[model samples]
Target: MRQGLIRLHCGVIEIENVSKRRGRVTVLDGVSFVARPGRVTGFIGPNGAGKSSTLRILLGLDHAQEGRALVDGSPFTALRRPLTCVGAVLDGSGAHRSRTGRAHLRWVAASNGLSRRRVEEVIELAGLESAAGKHVRGYSLGMGRRLGLAAALLGDPGVLVLDEPFNGLDAGGVRWVRDLVRTRARAGGTVLLSSHLMSELAEIVDDVVVISGGRIAARGTLDDVTGGHGSLEDAYFALTSS
Candidate 1:
């Protein structure tokens, strides 16, 4: 496994007063938070609390009706060779079912002008070598998640925006993700992990942002936000209940 040089250009993510609406439903209302470089920031919220919507806006997959999401002070869409700057895994698989894992990654690498060597490197990093030749449709949910993670690392990105990255993983896989996120942050990369599992977030995140009803309920370092609540899970329940 080749540990690449630390890229110094990774930037902080700033989401300011962003609001979004889907038809008549307001999915996000004044949602704001920051994922600083060299830290794992946890974005926690219940289902329908707009976590996914907020991530979509940040990735430039969807536009907000108000406010803005910026990466290193610029919109994601404006960046040249965006993948080299930020890597994202918004959902499951992110690949066609008929394609083998290797083929799926090869296409992404080709599109980004990344070398086959880089793809192989990420395959090893993601522990997907054994299953690399299998079609995605035959993969278990855990395998698919690993494949998505492999794709995300293909760019050796400075910033990682992963939504529910731990989903479908067994104990070993979960530990792998936890260590990987920590390693990335320690190397000066920014990581924003959105998940509903408070226990998992507590184990990895340096900062926590809690959302409820499309609004920011709390934001700060884990200790600051937990604030005598005993645990992140408790703090989250208390904050969202209010």
Candidate 2:
């Protein structure tokens, strides 16, 4: 099977035959794929299909029972000054509710040895200027997401891992994120994001990796993965339903 092997290159996201279990129930079964630079890769899957599990392992937030997840050809934890190489937005802002958005970003910057100026830069980049001073608890869902994106951008990293990046976003916000990630990819950044909004994903993803039942159902460029299908949605349902 395609997933039984892993071919890794320097400066890309690589997952090699990773499997995981919660007690006896398998969450991932030899899940493997790569996200290359200069393109956007969309990871799509139905709920409980192991999308989050794989990403968590990639980010070093979880351990795998087998196989590996690597960033830039090395395990994530082995990278010195990792934030400067990879930035991630997972599970909302990950900030204390009592902290103001600006405070949260400043704290992240300080922890990462990033400059305060960079924090402001990302705040503007994320369109969070007006809301930066508000406590995270008072921020709207979209505002919280913006804060997370802002923090993720603080290091100006070359790789981005985002989950549900379009969640809580309006049409305009979605368009903003699409443009942002496309620009990043155009600048030779490796962009990996997972989202359930297939239509929005189809607009920005250069490649697609679909997961079903904890394994890769499809992995290829958008055109190849969507072959003969009416749309990404059509291809997704057809692939997963089998």
Candidate 3:
């Protein structure tokens, strides 16, 4: 909701007239939004709003029947070493149950051609030092989420995309993630995070893209979209219900 120039490290992320379908159901329809660097772009809507489907296409996890999702003016498939360019926490469960926390990170680091030293650095950053040696299966939901974030940050990517990152977070975890996102934005990383709960998003996001029934319902700065109203919650209710 904060207003300022959009900084760029990886340029901008643009989703234009994108649509998706599964069998007889259409999951997304002409959905579009732009994510600028140095800002937290919140993708929000009620359940079944196509938030996840949109993110899936953006990450190249799924294909859109129409339209395009571009990063730095290029599709995700066009990027070399996509993971290095874009850190993602799409699933907060982390890695395999058989692997230890440290092992999981090491594998990810190795696959990305990153240094082993980075494994420890991300562990500390995610506050998982104590549990780093334990098997991932024993970790709590919050711990798993932290581990997922550590993996995402392993590359110090120019862009970060997180889906429902606050799903299993504790109050402390939520606060940590909020500040972490702002800090990452200030550090010049493009961030696109999704949450169904608009109230939680209003606290951290600078811009918002709301979707409903797989279509874009609203898009703009927090103040502009909300009309400097009482809160994003009020604006969200009006937009979605109307």
Candidate 4:
């Protein structure tokens, strides 16, 4: 984890009063959350609760009509090398199916001026070395996910924003992601993960931010958010069902 050794000057993610309107539909209304360095912050919400929208705005892929999304006190677009500052895996395969996994990673590395050695390192880190030479079309969902993660690690970024990363993995893959996330946080890197798997999130997340109806329903440390509830799942149902 050479990238994990890189010092994060300001790795905290602060989303303040972020609101978005899409064709008269308010996707996010006054949403706010904070993810600190060396912690795994779980972002959870129901479908259409604006989780994806918030991430997009934070990454500078989409604009927010109101409020601000800051990474280490500055917007993502302001960074000199965005990839090095933050690595993200959104909700899909970020590579072309026709291309080999290695080819896809090589192109991404070239785009970011990353060395071929770095790409190879990430491939091994992501456990894609065995299948990297195969075309993406033949790769399983878990393999594709590993490839996506390998690309994200190309820059050895300080911040990781992953959405539903455990969607299509076997038990081993799940454990791999869990260990990887924990390792990153322990190394003083910030991690913001969004997933519907309450059980898994409960196990690994140190803090959580729950969004409901385009607004933040609750935000705090795992114990704080869970309160007196028997489990995180119970608390989630209690908050979102209301």
Candidate 5:
């Protein structure tokens, strides 16, 4: 399918026939999808359906056994400064327990030659101002998620990849994340977010890609993919239960 490459304001991702394996078991089998600029593309599927594996390949954390994953027309490792092209939050618990939230951001900023002013801006943007000076060890799961999101934004990359960002959020936190993602899209960023829950995705995603049995079972805008289906939940059920 031409390797799926196309120029986007947030850069481009071309994934084609990407498959992966762990020992004798196949985790991903001929999976391909595109995340365009200015939209929240929700990657949803049943657990063990290869959603996480696809994301891992896209983020360059793991290599595919077959096919390819490319960013902006180039392999991820080939980018001179990768973070400048994409920001990712694949894990929410990578922060140091002893460091205050602001301190953690400061170090990350310095590594990228960014200023502390930028750090404070994102901290406030993520609604972490009240918790900025506190150690991450004390932050609740929802709070930690906010901090992780702030870290991802510090790069101001045009592309963002968030894995299960709403997993532990409360109602308020969930709403906050929804707005944050939408705002990024409006600003011309491409957002690829993964979630196991279809109900939550129905509220935030512009398009949905359903993965199942280590492959893409359905993909399109919510309405295009769902068609006459009662709901995203119903469409999901039909695809996986077949």
Candidate 6:
């Protein structure tokens, strides 16, 4: 529950005609989609289909050979107070194993000028209350994920970019992430989630953008994309199997 208050900084994610190449191997080819406020856009594709590549480009972690990825109409690297504008959870917790969960969060908060109170708030929200004092080195995969999510929310950001967010989670953790992302969208925030978990993605996503072979396969509302299939999973196979 987000207290029924809309986040004022809700942002739009626009990835337009983005293409990337690594040593003559195309990673993405003319991939384009938009994740607007109050919507959870699922970016679903098979392994090596460029889901991570596109997100990395959107986060300014890699260069796109052509086109552009924009957050709130500006490139991610060009944004002021970047973390405040977008909170991302990519790969893993991203916390150093030697540091306690709280230490890692506090460090990030301090660097971003975020208050310690905010860090604690996110820790609570992420259900890492008891684990906060434990070193990340000992945390389980689910715990590390919670820590990553907690760090992402420390800024109370309006835009969230998550890649395989459901990985390494139990049923309860899955529900936790599902509810959290839904709550954020309901609060007028924008979310772009990249995952190959068709069933899970179908539950919380409002829009669907399917990519394959380093290119876009389909894009539309959930119902629109799954209309002719038995379910999102069936549609996913139908769309990407070619």
Model 4 worst lDDT run, 10 consecutive residues:
1-10
Two-way lDDT contest, 2 vs 5, winner: 2
lDDT of 3 by residue, 143-197 (tens): 9999999998888787889999999999999998998899988877788999989
Candidate 3: segments with Cα more than 4 A from true spot: 1-7
Q: Which runs of model 1 end up more than 4 angstroms from their true locations?
A: 1-6
Per-prediction backbone clash count: 0, 0, 2, 0, 0, 0
> lDDT tens string, model 2, 1-242?
22111111324999999999999999999999999988999999888889888989998999999999988668998976677778899989999999999999998999889999998899999899899988889988888888888888887788889998999977777888899899988877889999766988998999999999999999999999999998999999999889
Q: Each prediction's TM-score against the native?
A: 0.96, 0.94, 0.93, 0.95, 0.92, 0.95
Model 2, poorest ten-residue lDDT window?
Answer: 1-10
Worst 10 residues of 5 by lDDT: 1-10
Please say which candidate is ahead in TM-score: 1 or 2. 1
lDDT by residue (tens digit), candidate 4, 53-134: 8999999988999999999889999987777878899875599989999999999888878899998999899888889999
Model 4, residue 80: what's the lDDT? 76
- Tens digits of per-residue lDDT, candidate 5, 151-208, equal 8888787788899989888999899988988987777778899888888888788888
- Tell me the lDDT of candidate 1: 0.91
Q: Which candidate wins on TM-score?
A: 1
What C-alpha RMSD separates each model from the true structure?
2.1, 5.4, 3.7, 1.8, 4.2, 2.1
Give the alpha carbon lDDT tens digit for every residue of 119-163 in model 1.
999999989989999999999999999999899888888899999
Q: How close is candidate 2 to the true structure, as a TM-score?
A: 0.94
Global lDDT scores for all candidate models: 0.91, 0.88, 0.87, 0.89, 0.83, 0.91
Give the clashing residue pairs of candidate 6, or none.
none
Model 6: lDDT of residue 31 = 92
- How many clashes show up in model 2? 0
